[model samples]
Target chain A: MAENREFFNRRLHSLLGVFPIGLFLMQHLVVNHFATYSPEAFNNAAHFMENLPLRVFLEFVLIYIPLLFHAVYGVYIAFTAKNNLRRYGFFRNWMFMLQRATGIITLIFIVWHVWETRLAHAIYGTEVNFDMMATILESTFMFWFYVVGVVAAVFHFANGLWSFFVTWGITVTPRSQKVLTYATLGIFIIFTYMGIASLIAFAY
Target chain B: MAEDHKTIRMIVQRQDEPEAQPYEEEFEIPYRKNMNVISALMEIRRNPVNAKGEQTTPVYWDMGCLEEVCGACSMVINGKAMQSCTALIDQLEQPVRLEPMKTFPVMRDLAVDRSRMFDSLKKVKAWVPIDGTYDLGEGPRMPESKRQWAYELSKCMTCGVCLEACPNVNSNSDFIGPAALSQVRLFNSHPTGSYHKAERMDALLDDGGLQNCGNSQNCVQACPKGIPLTTSIAALNREATLHSFKSFFGSDYHH
Candidate 1:
């Protein structure tokens, strides 16, 4: 029973990283990318997402719950993981270390992000619009912080897809793994561009 | 450091006791045309003298057959975990460095206690279970294709090189490593060994089992036998996932 519990939990952790969490990252980046057009365009897009049916419930169940578990369990995994980059300096070994590093980074970034936008919206009734983000990013420190945070989050998800495939028995062959490495690197670049570009549009 | 044309310079990492601090002793030997690392170690043993010409205790290393088989000659050759018996001197860059694999407890100099791997074999029951007391004739026949694939897996000699290269198998983590995991896939596929398939899968599902694999993939590259370790691990991952589902929903769902 104990064995099965752990097996199920670890699989759940791996699954949650890709599903709503990864999918949500892509959607969130797209929503923010609207700022590249104009303030009104960004405001309209954010407003539409905010007014969705059962928005609060969906966020709580899908996003918050899974994020909480992934963060807590992921933190445990990160701290416990023994990184051996010195002895084994292979590409995948470096990725193993970076994966843990980025998991922690993404956690901190998400917490601060949620506190700034979502919690502020609830507490002060501040409108979650283009101006709010622009004002936040106006600070040089905050601008860089969001930039690093977005990049880290995107990297964690993209590189994690490679592990996801191998872990779940999807990419068994070395050739498949090699192919997926390039594919994930492409994902990282494309998503990172969308994310950083959105942040730049807001900041400047 | 200029290399002498006729001699090979080698640095050996030596530990006097299992719990003692390790130190390096350099030796310059008259290089033969076709000598390997094991033969070099034998030369050092014959002289038992360091580069300073000071007599030292004979360096300890385990070896058998003077070939890659028997898996006894596995050590870190020039910082790479591999069979020292087959490490030809001409192929290695000097000064050649030899060290005991850190994945296991060093019993002396180069000899390490590979009990963890042996224990994992027992945990997964990497064997064909049958009563030897009675005449059990004509075991279940396996096809030539299956035999060829199984023979590839059977080539593993528990060399410990895979564990040495695996970052996931370290001091803090108790990951069973890739060798035993591959053995599980090997045995589980056997005709008669399939009876205890659930038992082996359960062992892999336990702590320090499949969940601990970070999939850094160094094991496949470091394996001396060219075993498809990552492929076996990935296949087991699929099997483990299905095993959990079957257990959770009850076996009746399979029909």
Candidate 2:
């Protein structure tokens, strides 16, 4: 029984990465891209999300719960696994290390980001609109931090999707894995571009 | 002209006993043509002298089949997990560093307890089952194409090098590592072994099985036999998925 749970836990970790977390990131990038369109559109989208019926419950189930599980389990995996980049400097080995590193950075950024935005808005009932994001991004340090955090998050999700395929038995053959590698790289480029564009929208 | 003299320097990580802390010891041996790491160690063992010209206890290590076949001589040589018998001194940089493979507990000097690997092999049942001691009439023949990969898989000598190179297999984690996972593919492919396929697949679905693999791809590169460990793992993942589906519905579902 214990053994089976461990097996399921690992698969659950991979599944959560693609479903709610990866999907959430993609949805977030698209919604934030509304800022590039107009501040009014961005505010409307944010307002819609914030005012949904059972909004707190939805966030707890769809976002916070899954994110907490993924992040905590990710940290456990990173701590337990050894990094062999110095001896075996294979491309995949380096990717494995980078995945863990980005996970750590993304966790820190997400915690701070959530505390700064969502929690503060919830507790103090602060207006979370276009002006608030623009104000936050106006600071040089905060802007750079968001850029780094976005880049790390994008890479983690993209590279994680590639590993997800292998982990879940979706890409078995070497040829298929190679194709997925290119697809994953394509994802990284596109999502990163979207993330950077969204951040740039705040800068102006 | 004075005859030119040459010597090789090696820094060996040593432990007095299993419970003792590890320490580094330097030894210098007269250079010999085509000397392997094991040969250099033998020279040091014979002399039992430190580079500072002080008397010391003979260094201990494990070896068998002086060739790489037995897998008993695996250790971390110059930051790489490999057979000491195959690691040539000429190819290695000066001050070659030797340490026991950290994936397994250090027994002493350069030897380690590889019982974990053997235990994993048992977990996966990496063998063909037979009815009795008497010879069973000719077993089914394997097709040449399938036989080819099976032959490749059979080359695993239970060397802990793959375990060493793997990031997932470590002290804190209960991961069984790549060797046993590859063995699952090998044994399950056998005609008679296939009879117990469900059992093996179930074992793989257990904890410390295929799920522990993080897809680092180091095991394939670090394997001295080049056993294609990751490919086997990916294949096993597919099989396990199918097995789970079959279990969920019925065995006849796949049939």
lDDT of 2 at B209: 87
Q: What tens-digit string does per-residue lDDT give for candidate 2 at B48-93? A: 9999999998888999999899899999999999999999999999
- Per-model lDDT: 0.90, 0.91
Clashes in predicted model 1: 0
- Model 1 spans with C-alpha error above 4 angstroms: B1-5, B132-134, B252-255
Q: What value does the lDDT take at residue B42 in candidate 1?
A: 92
Q: What is the C-alpha RMSD of each candidate to the true structure, in Å?
A: 2.4, 2.2
| C-alpha RMSD in Å of predicted model 1 compared with the true structure | 2.4
**Candidate 2 Cα deviation (angstroms), residue A48:** 5.1
Identify the runs in model 2 with alpha carbons over 4 angstroms from their true place: A1-3, A47-57, B1-4, B132-136, B251-255
| DockQ result, candidate 1 | 0.67
Candidate No. with top lDDT: 2
Would you give the TM-score of chain B in model 2? 0.95
Here the TM-score of candidate 1's chain B is: 0.95
What candidate 1 keeps of the native contacts, as a fraction, is 0.65
Q: Which ten residues in a row are the worst by lDDT in model 1 chain A?
A: A1-10
